[model samples]
Target: MTNWTRKALLLSVSAAAVAGTLTAAGAPVAHGRPAEPIAPPLAWGPCEPIPGTPVPAGQQCATLRVPLDYRVPGGPGVDLAVTRLRTDRPEARRGTLLVLAGGPGGSGVRRVAQKGGALRAATDGAYDLVGLDPRGVGGSTRANCALPEADRHVVTLRSWPAADGSITENTERSRRTAASCARNGGPVLGSFSSRNQARDIDRLRAALGERKLSVWGHSYGSYVAAVYAQEHPNRVDRLVLDSTGDPDPTRVGYGWMANVGPAVALRFPDFAAWAADPAREAEGLRLARRAEDVEPLFLALARELDREPRESEVPGVPLTGNLLRQALHSSLDSDAGFAPLARLIRSAQDPRGRPALPPGLAGAIPDEDASVMMAVICNDVRWPGPDSGYAGRVAADRARYPLTAGLPANIAPCAFWKYDREPKPVRITDEGPSNVLMVQSLRDPATPLAGALRMRAALGDRARMVTVGQGGHGMYLGNGNACGDRTVSTFLVTGKRPARDSHCPN
Candidate 1:
């Protein structure tokens, strides 16, 4: 029933290219969590197709019924949106490996189709690739805030402060937003927490009929995978966490935002170098004659925008300081994005030039995505409530991390969020298999090396991490060097992770 063809078309663009083969083991280690016999095979069938996308040649889609609430297994259930790209090399297939997408809001069913080929090539066709939309995301059951179109805009959804450091506006907006979510957001919204996402993953494993599941998770997905492994350690065969987060329970979104300061500071040099390069001159995007001058120039530009908002393609929506900051925040996530940001800075600083707006400034984030991104972080952990508490933190954070200013540590709508965490946060421990392989970038603007180190420390000897002396979020064929990619691919395919933690030279 699925629009297999439509799905395929959308996925082909994002999927990685496949290459040479690598042979590896299919069997799990004997003494560890004994592999239980595989469950009864699922009667795989055609998926209800999404119009305008193609299903992989042999892949199919099915709905996995999971409890709406994990604590009550017999309660009403929701259908987890799922898809599979089976291993072409069945003889080499070990088991099904599920891909957990980043963003409690990210769609994984689409991600598999995008990255399937490269992933298969990475593991040498050793496992079937699969993914799903967590509850309250696309193609799964969903929830919406009924938020105003203006508030749904990305710039506003993230809680950018007023042109000045005055968060008076942000504070009022945060309170109203919290009230809106509590009002219009329903039962499914409450179910968007990470705990239930982990439970849904386990149900998906059972539905797939696998004795054990390997995982490749990115960004927020890394947090979900970490929690999953903690809750169901015996169910995991191998795990790969890329672009992880701080597992600190005390300061959920607060810590995540606080981290952005240093994360951006770490990433600023990358932009500076790119902006100063003579090569960027051809694009009329060079910002500074020297690399080191770029940061100060940007600080000046932000101050300029703060004082006099510049009009762009989006009428009435002048480029504000927070918008510029958010732009920098998004650009640092990937290297490919650096040039555009450099160009923007160049245009903004040009005396006679009026630059165009960056893509989607006026566009609306889908209602469901808006709800989950805010909900998951707020619902998973608590946030500080007092405005004075945030003011003091912001002032200190701004002084220490000028690149991100006080943004990372600023208050969000979560401060006014109604629902408390449903359960204690899952604490990642070193009690699992020795099959996990972590790949991280040294200067990731989103998930910094510092946090990844926490995850590595938590996993202890149960894992081996390959720290790439490079910058950018998402590693292992995403932003990593060949040696780093080779290391992770080797572990995924062969089950031979690093004998110890190692570093990949820049």
Candidate 2:
């Protein structure tokens, strides 16, 4: 449920039918076709008995052994952690509805716990709710790059330049991070592509004894679900893609980072309205007297920080202009994040006190978490290099959208990745079954509405869309938009979709 969900998705689309079972080779599987040969069945047991994350009661867990490299089937296997909340009414149970969580880093086993109750109520026991930790995630076959602690810190990992927006430190760190991953991540890290995750989804379905899967995909999960729908169109039932990003094959993950420029601009007004509201006065969170004054006040503070970085409670790491700007971006992922971000800002502005860092930026990420986050994106598609005029683009993006402070346009380790692209990035086409439904928030800070529209276009008539007039990264159960939630849950339960694009007002 963190702000970002782009984690690991393995496999790439191919032409050959992945019949009998999809080996790691990622043999292309046709849509709707029921392949006879299936993977071994999963051994279901108590999930709460496990240590890490606790699953809800009645939620059972299982482990499926998928090939580390599908291309090399019959080789060593990776344990994919899977969970399911069975229908309360067996007579009403139609099939399994798989929920793919956001984050290349989001843990599906955990997401199932968070949204399980709401989903059961929405579907009225019509389908079982299922989810999994994709490869490289928790409870699954885990992999770590063993990156340096300094490089793993959010402030450093994000490639935010110095206060003045210089790229010197950023460039060195990007290259170093990439080098360490290439040296330490090994094959498991290399195996974290979204295409592969699509294949992994099929394997999960086979293990669950489901001929086809109903999907509720969120954030990066939307892209994974789209890939599965494209590769095995026949194998999908009702597909709900929530908070999707652009399916631009060439840019993939890198483009998503860049789109933050427009995404933040589109959603900042909502935050301004919240920040300047009279209701916030009691909390000492008001940034300005009027909503219009919020933007100027924020920009002024950032510039002042740029000139003079203030020390944070966290040792060594100071509160810089970009850190403040990045905090704003993170807050917009959900309205719930608004108060903490506001408090952080207010603390930073205190002249006599040490500013506190946001939890996300206070410390370095876990090595395995950071590794997969980078591997999945880098493995999915290529990013721009210095030769591509990224500096010029960064300058333009920063000028046009100062709120993002050019971090969106800055280079990432992917720009200097040593590994080659997988079988290639998967392109979403209209050739598959028309089973996909999309729900998007108009003012989402991440995966903006514009990208979701492109995804809508890419799916062609194969998909229908519902636009929720809200401001958040995820719209379904997370954002509490009843119209949007009902629209999606109905499609899952009844397999019916809106005939055309529909808008649900705030």
Candidate 3:
């Protein structure tokens, strides 16, 4: 669920953030189809540091040219910015490991730069780490819907419903956003779909001159990775899917959004416990003496802000209930986000104090970034039509899960998107080699355990799952659980997974 909202908020906090058959003429043939030209070798060079992301020392960069549409192999292409951090000990290097960053719009090049060093150490220099900026992301070819500045804000983009659970505003926003993208975003935007992304990965693998590739994918990337594995099962080796969601082809993106409501309910207790701790008193961050009181306090504050939005640090953007709820969703991703959230909550509770908006909520996201995020989800699967009784669903969801306030069920830009008639999403199955390993947090605010279990079930014998007794997204090398990290790291390095499904204590 590294959708626009989560991606934007996470970025604001710290400024964070395949196989082929062969043919003559260096082209690959697939399933009796005519041969398609293989991507040319990438010319690796010194990587330029991406703004707000540190490039690891000695990381090399390159670009791969992939067709905008695979069906038109000789058509205009898009440039994929690629990065690699070669292992220091090439003597022990096994192969190349691709880092699949989360988000349909996540920058894999940035992810490689950020995690290369730690990953190298974790695998004991067993593989060269490499990643690429998926199309419409980072240094790759980008697209824009010419969205209004107001439409680009994370809160607005997320389609948060009105305080009373009315989705009228959301419906209008979704319609216009869809219209804007259709009117402004050309074939480039239309080309951004998960299947295309999976095809892009195969092109990346070929460009790297590897017959097989291992992968480490988290969040939405896990879904992409799974699709790639399903599409090209024989080309994958030592796969690790971290914090994945259900891969219901009919409802790929919609299912993910729907899961957020239940997921947040499960993960909020962790934050409530932390916020109610006696130790937080010294820091002036405690919200309640009892853990049970924290949820009510937060809900009351949100409702109050709903009726009367409070002024925020951002001059023009006031703190509305949806914005506060958005902040809570972002904060619940990790324990580290608790303090800033607590501070914001405390400030909001004060009569005269002005709340400081999270960076993601302070302003609009870049046009291209927003475009890609919207395009991929909308393009992947057809969403419910405007007449799908979204209002009734939102009302029911709001009553069932007050924490999310019906946002998860509200209509989104996808509901009105003009899809390019792309084929349906591939259904993930247990057809692949049994070389996949999965590590999931018991309480991921985004991906959630229920969805992860569905993914695990879909993969069946093709994978083994390690459920981490933790509460956060990204299980490996994230959320600070040694047991989960070790399980995934060991699998990546040694190709030895637990005999079956296992649990890792926090």
Candidate 4:
């Protein structure tokens, strides 16, 4: 609980497994799933160990070489760290299932290593599970802005306003941070966009010798999956998009960030209900006598912290209002986050208590890690500049949703970033294969149901959507949503989708 500890937390966030585009003029050449050629045996070997989460014994790792830019396939290439957990029941094996991690910054290798066992069990050994770290992320081709340590911290990167709630500092930080990334991040960094990532996925498919891929792409990964499906339709057998952000082709990443204004409002009540419950008393986390009162209690606390931040276990970095908001944003990703958030609230309220920063926010994120987050979002598409009335938007956002206090709506480095080398963000189309299945949580904060619906709409008749009456970012294999999980797994194993768009009762 020192400043160093908090800094440690930030570095981990940057390193945590968490990344580009193609265009309309060069629209995807019409194609379907590639030929059903047997993928050559992976040079299977033991997986590298990850701290805290051990790799399942069955998992194997390998690397695929992909060009940093698809346009020059003959040019220099980067290694895509790939992982696989083969089916024990090879006789029952269906095909390969690609698992895509969220966070334009998420590490696919780490994600597969983490979820391999449960995925194998859930799919009944139906397919060999495979994952690939995208460029600018873990185990793949890496890049960094070498951003000043001061700017690498998530708190600073998050665009939180000054104590008086002024955006002047935020604007300068945004500009400075953008300038730093552009200066230190070279060609590799410039190539960090969704369009490139999708192309990389296809190249991996070729390397694996899989004709058709069954993919499960979560959160930001869902958008990646959608783009893949659109670009190469026939090559996909079954596509599952879980907990997706809105892919308004025009707005891209910034749109998703702005939508957070309404997203948290939608998901916060669930946290409130949990925090107000009688059962929480056992945990010393009960925050309010009634669920309805939880809103005022939380908003007031944020304002109080804004006025006077409390000292945290980490030195120098006090428990400020935006930090609480940051923790809340992450907590809404699932119900499991409820207790810790409640505990944080309890700590902040205690005069003698010191709040511990959330694991993801306690310290500064890695330079490369922070770079990945910033690069992909900043490069994927263009955003509002100084003339775009961002201050007015932030003011409106803060006025309408005091709980968010404009962090969701504030200007990001992308607003000042240069994306000249970045190709157009993928246009998710309804013309793709009808093999896609989307699962969404009704009350997800990070990727709310509303945004998922936009994705469903974009996919149109090409996809079937299942909305779950739950409260979390990921519904399938997450959030304990049995109905939702079963729905997705059934479709994957049996190839039968719901008759129509449907709801999975909580």
For all candidates, the clash counts are: 23, 27, 0, 29
Query: Which candidate number would show the highest lDDT if scored against the true structure?
Result: 3
Worst lDDT 10-window in candidate 3? 15-24
Across 345-380, the per-residue lDDT of candidate 3 in tens digits comes to 999988898888887789998888877777777877
Q: Is candidate 1 or candidate 4 better by TM-score?
A: 4
Residue 376: error of model 1 in Å?
A: 0.7
lDDT for each residue of candidate 1 in 304-404, tens digit (9 for 90 to 100): 98898777767767777767876787777778888878777777777676767666454566566677667777676656774548877777778788766
**lDDT string, candidate 4, 219-266, tens digits:** 888889888888788788999998888888788777788777788899
What residue pairs are clashing in model 3?
none
Q: After superposition, how far is residue 398 of candidate 1 from its true place, in Å?
A: 1.5
Give per-residue lDDT, candidate 1, residue 163.
Answer: 56
Best TM-score among the predictions, by candidate number: 3
Ranking by lDDT: 3, 2, 4, 1
Clash count for candidate 1 is 23
**Candidate 3 overall Cα lDDT vs. reference?**
0.81
What tens digits encode model 2's per-residue C-alpha lDDT throughout 1-506?
A: 11222222111101000001111235555556746445988788887543344567899888888888876678777888888999998999999999998777778888888889888989999999899998888778877777788877666777766666677788888878777777777777777888889888988888888888899998888989998888888788888999898999987787778777888899999989999999999888988899989899889989988888899998988998877886787778788888988888888788887898876777777777777777788777766764677677777888899897777888778777765433377889999778888999998877888888999999999999999988878889868488998898889889888889999897
lDDT of each: 0.71, 0.78, 0.81, 0.76
Answer with 3 or 4, whichever has the higher lDDT: 3
Q: What TM-score would every model get versus the actual structure?
A: 0.89, 0.92, 0.94, 0.93
Candidate 3 positional error at 271, Å: 0.4
